[model samples]
Target chain A: MKFGPMKPQRRNRLLLVLFVVLAAASAVGLALSALNENMNLFYSPGQITAGEAPTGVVIRAGGMVVAGSVLRATESLRVDFVISDLQGADVNVSFTGILPDLFREGQGVIARGILGRDGNFVAEEVLAKHDETYMPPELVDVLPDSHNDPETFKGGTRQ
Target chain B: MRFFSLPDYQLIMLNWFHRLGAPRSFYEISGRLLPVLWVLSGLSILTGVIWSLGFVPEDYQQGNSVRIMYIHVPAAIVAQSGYAMMAVAGAVFLIWRIKIADVALQCAAPIGASITFLALVTGAIWGKPTWGTWWVWDARLTSTLVLLFLYLGIIALRSAMENRESAGRATAMLALVGVVNLPIIKYSVDWWFTLHQPSSFSLGEKPAMPAEMWIPLLVMVLGYYLFFFTLWATRMRVEILNREFRTDWVQRLVVGS
Candidate 1:
């Protein structure tokens, strides 16, 4: 089709469509901007340590659960574990609830609770986050155990 | 029918496209094509289900629960594409006043909404086991829910209007406005720190899955698209007959059938 356009009616309809599109775009843009913070499911441990997350209010903090950092109470459902982004300072998380089945050492986990003044997160609930890559157990066993260390593991698949 | 000389291939394709747009032609052609689609889609879905559920090995992290991906992903993929197709039809009807395109837009909304609902329910089922919750207010999840609502809104808007011409234009405009949400739904996980993971498969990159796993997924996705086409065509034909019943050609078709 030729690019020349001189029809008045077609041009008017085209302009009308463009106006509608621009109006819808700006409306959604403003709404998203207003809800930007709440849109993030959880704040990363790095963000928490950087003093970005507010204390005393219920918020979500998430990162890889540190290996061998889980401390379980023998008499109660209480458990304490340290979470980290592996590139920043660790954040201790304490919860008195049952953890998700997928929660494990070196796995991505998000906890909702209040951060105390002592720099500890008191969690009300914990949820696990799995990565995109999927392979059989046999394949996983064959691959080198490079993911064991939190630093080199590319933990959490952020971004 | 050609007004000017054209390349043989281009002329043939143009003829076919225009013929396919006619309500009577579409009804006749789709009647011949439906059985083929049914068989192909049914066979592929059967194979995909057996392969994904029983043959593929379990994931190291999720184990057997990973099979839910076979259903959830395809439903999500097709649901989005269906909305896009419906919106394009709506746009065509609005811009060109094509009655057939309006029929297509009207027929597609309910099927697309059902598929979107399927995706949401399957995602919730999958999420409860892996993410420890039935739902989340994250960007990805919320945007998909918005997609469902958009489909519902389009369907509701169509029914509420008494004038067919005005209803078609209104729904078309609404669909065009809601087109903005498609990109947001696609990039939500990337834009926000959601519990939902980024897509494992993309057209531009190799899938983040083994060949054995993704092949069946490919079959399932294909089957879903084919199933949608079959259903959509059938619905469009029924609607065309309903609207054109008073016409001489439709009367003849009814008598012949």
Candidate 2:
């Protein structure tokens, strides 16, 4: 594909330099924006009351599983529960998905969504029951565990 | 660290960035930064696992398994970004013929390959629990896996060439051709319906995690990016110093040794 002498080498070089500079700039840009994201809004309930929680925005409320909060619905697929920031704020969350085997009365959980106009925290996504092992990230843990098998939790069988 | 940090930290960090402006400053820096970067990368990753696994809450929908997002999401992001860095580096190398670009591409290809591999493996792990299988032909999943192979291909081709210029050009051509995968991987879920989920951690949408969960994940991601930079700067430094060894500055720097 060599054409007598003038190839696009010069142009290619210019474009390459432009791209590299752009990449480094973008990485720096992402980092800067990450830093600018409100810091005070991050702490949990105890931190919230201590004047540590930043105001004016509806931020994620996180915490441990509260005992006696789980209730299976009498009617539909709905299951209801509450998670506390452990700092003292309790957010009631509702979901209709198949419950994971590891879900229990006292465990960590985080739900994304928001505080509904009705005051309940609505979660579009929920993560339940975590452990201290390295697992691939996704909708479920890749590690082998009994949670995937439903019998361990209580009366339920693996679905 | 104190014994070494006060006297050496700034001197070392500056020397690397300065040499980054040149292709050669890397030789001096790589010796120091590689161990540190590798340590940090591995450590932060483990830390992320510990915190998310123990402290983070279970998703209302996914339940206990939801923690997989911590590793899968970040690895996938890093894979795409690393390839992008390599492509940009290739483009720069082609244009300016700067050894820095060449060093970047060389160092980047392997790292990108590794990150791509991590993404695929993690995605599979995640998919198995949710998608009901270890592998999916989903647009997002397939494209990302392809990205990994493409990285390996470029690296192999680069090594296959006898002449450095020819190798750079050949690999550059491959990278350019492969650039299409970038957009495809990005919009794959939107481009076609796939089993793989849409991005959960995005800026525009409502964030899915409470402050406690996502913050740790974000920190882990930053640590990964910094780890990459630290590695790149070190590798580039080593490369430049080695290549420029015959020059007057090299002679003096070596003589000063």
Candidate 3:
């Protein structure tokens, strides 16, 4: 059997269908772009420190927990740690609850609460964020400095 | 008539395509294809599971929990690709009014939904130990949840409509609309600040993990694709036979078998 050309009527319908699909896709794309900032899970320390994030209202700030910045209270569940963007901006987060299992020095964390007038972030809850890369203990031990390098794990900050 | 004539091979390809659109032809082709697919998928999945759980080393940070990636990542990957395939089938059905295309779309929804659910559940399980939270409404996680809902929504939409013809067209339109979410799910991590990290593997770039880690993952991913195709084709064949049971070919095949 010989292959035949599409009828003009059918060809018009195909073009109309393609046009509808493209138009719908672009509409959704525009809507998503408009809602982009609201879709972010948390604010980076850089944003918060720059006053880009609103103060006194409940908000979430996230970054790597600065190494050696954690201070635990002896009698209470209260803990204070500085989360940093690792590019100079830092925010102090004070929480009075149990931290998540992955919460540790140099680990990425998101704290939810209020930013105080004193520039301290009073966190009601804290959640850790893990990077995508994975390696064995032996491999990690071989390159201990790599883990400590902020450049290796820039996924911690939003910006 | 004004368009240039097709070559012999092109004509042959077009003939084969048109024939495959018929349920009887598809049934015969799939009957010969199913056994090979099932055996290969089974072997690949078995090897992949054993290799991932026992042979691969634990992550330095996440330890044993990192093993969840073998299932979680593959499920997510297959689930997204499944939706894309379903949408393509929907488009074909819409454009050509092909019965087999609609049948394929109908059969794929539930399986795709189940796989998407697996991805979400396994993700939450893995997140608890490694991310310190069971769930977070981050861009990546939220987009994936939307994907699961889209699958369920499609299935529900199909069942809700009484007319087969209108249901097929409606579901096709819905599937096409939701196709926009696939790219959102993929780029959410990179596009926005989310608790979920960016993908470890990307086309045209070196994988973030070492060869030892990614090799088994690659195997598991391919195995999952094979497994999905095996299940999809099996479901398609069963549905085709059920829809065509009154036809002579189907009755004769049933009696002969």
Candidate 4:
């Protein structure tokens, strides 16, 4: 009887609550999409193995910066490097923005912004993906054996 | 296309309002006046649509998107000023125990929320072409968004209570406390390092816009105020009747109907 059209309409508090929630969610989605004019693709090296990256997707490629591949300009602050997930394939990244002082070769980095038409990753922003002594919430699912104790911190050496 | 300097508008409107808040007089008057006010509201809205959509010249920089200014800026100003009026009414109600002021505060909350919503939506639409983003954590936008939440909170608080008097007093306290945030919300952009552009629609200084643009905007402002007056009056009439059902005036009206 409740399902029929002729049925007496109840207060339907659940419907009202859902309406409010959906309205708020849509508004927030619109607001955020407007905030960042550009979008970034997030992936590890394995995802790119099947095919080459599309021509114009702004992406965050997570990888280890190969040691000695970091060629810092002596006069200028520009740093040139190659990033690979230790999975054989690598991409060159160029950044002119302020690089964090701790940034060095063989550390994990997430470089965001567009992949240049010329096959280079044109990084608009770069953040150091430093490993912590204590476990982090973000690392929970990603780590297979991340011990909670400091001394039990296992090898995280980059290839 | 043309501007009219009608100095008599506000003065004439004030006389109409003098009888409006008087419960018995307005309850008797609305039957005769409702049609005229409704028609006037429709006409004013239609004229705004025609002028803002087709008549006004496009901004050199903003082009067609600037037309949204007619709705967004007017709504934002209404939203802010309406909340301020409600807070003042809340104070009057609390201090003087005026039922009419309480009714006014009760009626203002939802309308303020709607106006705030209209402002945010139009601002976002306009932002797409102008700021290259729809949402920015710029102080003005952030504060205005907070204002929308405050209006919502007041409405919810009022409705949550079963007793009318308790609801009114409770909401009045909240509105008064919220009043301090108004100045902060208004000047937040000036005080903070924000991505939002500084206020262009100022109340004090002469506006930077050409007379043609500002004149129509001024007309729209008048029209919005008139619309608000008309609604407030009608809603107050209904409230007075419902609250004072046992009174002779309400009894007479009920018999007349």
Candidate 5:
């Protein structure tokens, strides 16, 4: 439908609206693409075990480090640990670096890397994901019902 | 083309802008808005802060420290958008030669810079426990740092210029150029492997946080926006009075007050 009488002011308003629409459209388009490409989706051990995680893709997997699952190499910085979603599923993760001081067994952690063919999480980086206080969010639900108390939920020591 | 012509509505809108550009009208109109804005800003911020800090459950992971999010996230958000708002005002002053727009640009700079500073300080404080390091050259952190510098640069450029008109024009250009950094600061965590986490809030996607965690955050964010507008209007009024001291209306306003 043709627009009615093109008064000068009406035409200016239309032009301004058109310009703004075009700018907004392009900005939204750019932002969507950036978000799509850049979003490093986080997955849980359940998703990883179920083969829902994209293979060979760099993604974040977060969960509590399985109690007493840590194994440190004698001669190297390489360490192996198991992460569990606290819902019957788990992922074995291996990393070669100085673990963050906060990293420990039974605490929440997020490992960024690829899931290996042999069902291991080959982590490029392992971050201890606790807040200022001791409790890690990911581990809170995973802990046994009896260990729900914040005061009682302490870090698991390596045996 | 007929589309290029200025229509009647457009002229009316322009006329409104022109009228509002005058210091006297702005002073009067903004004066009416001041008390309402003050009450809204004060009530919202006070409620949001108290609710988030006391009533909200401690984050399962971050614990009490997650309380920082109530302040940090809101400050960071407002700080970034405040710069964009300043830049728009700068553009208006440059294109339309609106003295009020220039005053807005001048008044917004320090406030924006101060908020940006707050964001940085809070982020660093939050970083210590979460990241295990007080500082990292991560993409999000670095881009935010760059944003602070841009705000500082605009403030510095404005003060350095001896001529008021030149200062306005130069700072306007700088602000326009600095627009490139806004998106960068926003997308940095998503674009690269960064210790800093990705945005919790995004349009058309479910918030990464649970409603319980995010609801108070929304309240704080709203509070911060209101607070910024309140401060912005208050500062603009002071600036209008200062700039229009020679005008009769301002003389009357000063004497009456």
Candidate 6:
């Protein structure tokens, strides 16, 4: 079996450079296309209420869980809760699973699922959105008049 | 236009790259540094793991499952950066014909692949409790899986080639081509709404977690890096010995041992 030349000539160097450049360009093109199809940006309750969110598409709707809005079924795991954008618009979310330990009224939550025909956010998954020490910035940003005083915000309670 | 117009500082840096690219120099220098790296890795990882598991307060939400972050996050961070380092070595081998760079690239792939696998497995375990699913085809998860495959591909390509020089060149090219996936993995969470949360750590920004939680995580990250370097140096030494089996230094060392 013959081995390729170890020493790289100018032509071989140029070829390698060209190959790398072309490969990178094609990879970026492919990535952008995949991203176009797969990108699922989170929307606020305001966006959902204003019809900015696409119907029947898997997307994230995030906001503060409205106080006194949690309704858990006695016989089943189904739960209904309303999340507020802090701008007077609220999106009703229905989830059929055990809520995370952090799930609570007045806490920030993000629901992932498609919007139902009845305009309810049918959440396949619900995630409580806060770190050990700080609330997620998205939640903090949507809290009404509390962005300036995030420390006082209900969801900003440090553990 | 000047065909090669590198600044003085860059030229000086290039000289160091060339000098260090020699296998003998790399072996000698890394041999001197290996013990320190081993000690650092062992000590820091031990301390960090203990601190995180035993001392830090449980997460407000995830509870004990959150302890997995100590290993999960560090493994993921190191796995991604390891690929970046391997690609840089691959480029050096290709552009400068550095034999030691090829060794570095080869040694790094298996370690990176293992770390990437660890990241994926730990991530899945963490998700089981937090996200209520063992796996999701989220952007971050999918891109990271791609990264693991890229590492495996480079490893397989090198082993399959019959000629050593051709093998190095082939794997180097593959490694360079795979570099595009790194940035995609980094930004996947930001670019797409994913079940995987965005990174809690960022440069020049205060960490979202408290000091008690993040400090141990920082230590763990450092430990993982040191661990990679320790293993990398050890692997490179073995490669150097294999390549220089006919040389007098290795013969004398073997006889002396």
Worst 10 residues of 4 chain A by lDDT: A150-159
* lDDT measured at residue A74 in model 4 versus the true structure, 0 to 100: 80
Candidate 6: which stretches are off by over 4 Å?
A1-15, A18-26, A41-64, A84-89, A106-114, A123-159, B1-19
Mind sharing the TM-score for model 2? 0.57
Instruction: List model 5 lDDT by residue over B60-155, tens digit each.
Output: 656687888889999999999999899888777665567888999888888888898899999888877765666655557777888889889988
lDDT (0-100) at residue A90 of candidate 1? Answer: 89
Question: All candidates' lDDT scores?
Answer: 0.86, 0.63, 0.86, 0.64, 0.75, 0.78
**Residue A4 CA displacement from its true place in model 2, Å:** 29
Task: Name the runs in model 5 displaced over 4 angstroms.
Answer: A1-69, A72-159, B1-16
- The TM-scores, one per candidate, come to 0.93, 0.57, 0.93, 0.57, 0.68, 0.80
Measured with C-alpha atoms, the lDDT of residue A103 in candidate 5 is 81
In candidate 4, list every pair of residues with a backbone clash.
Answer: A34-B134
Candidate 6 lDDT tens digits, B1-257: 34157677866776766667777777788888888899999999999999989987776556687889999999999999999999888887787677898999999999999999999999888877776567767678988999999999999999999999999999988888888888878887666555566677778987766677788889999999999989988998999899888998889888995
A1-159 per-residue lDDT for model 6 (tens digits): 112354556447757756895789697868686666345446767767878778988887877788899999999999999988566778899999988766777766778899976779999888765433433233444545322212212221112
Clashing pairs in 1: none
Full ranking by lDDT: 1, 3, 6, 5, 4, 2
lDDT of 3 by residue, A3-73 (tens): 36776766676676677678888998999878877888888888887888889999988888999999999
Tens-place lDDT digits, model 2, residues B120-206: 887777765653457644456767888998999998998889998888877876776677678768765443324444454556765
**Deviation in angstroms for B253 in model 3?**
2.2
Q: Which digits, one per residue and each the tens of the lDDT, describe model 4 over residues B59-151?
A: 544456667778877788788898899887876666545677788888888888888899999988876665445765555787789889888
Per-model TM-score (chain A alone): 0.82, 0.47, 0.85, 0.53, 0.60, 0.59
Docking quality class, candidate 4: incorrect
True contacts kept of 6: 0.21
lDDT of residue A94 for candidate 5: 92
Report the C-alpha lDDT of model 1 over A1-159, residue by residue, as the tens digit: 222454676667667767777899899989987887777888888778878889999998888999899999999999999998888668999999888989999888889999998889999999998777788888887776533334322323334
RMSD of each: 2.8, 15.7, 2.7, 19.9, 9.3, 6.8
lDDT of 3 at A44: 85
Question: For residues A29-135, what per-residue lDDT tens digits would candidate 2 score against the true structure?
Answer: 47534643332112233433444434444454445567799888988878788766543566677877665444566655444455654446655545442422222
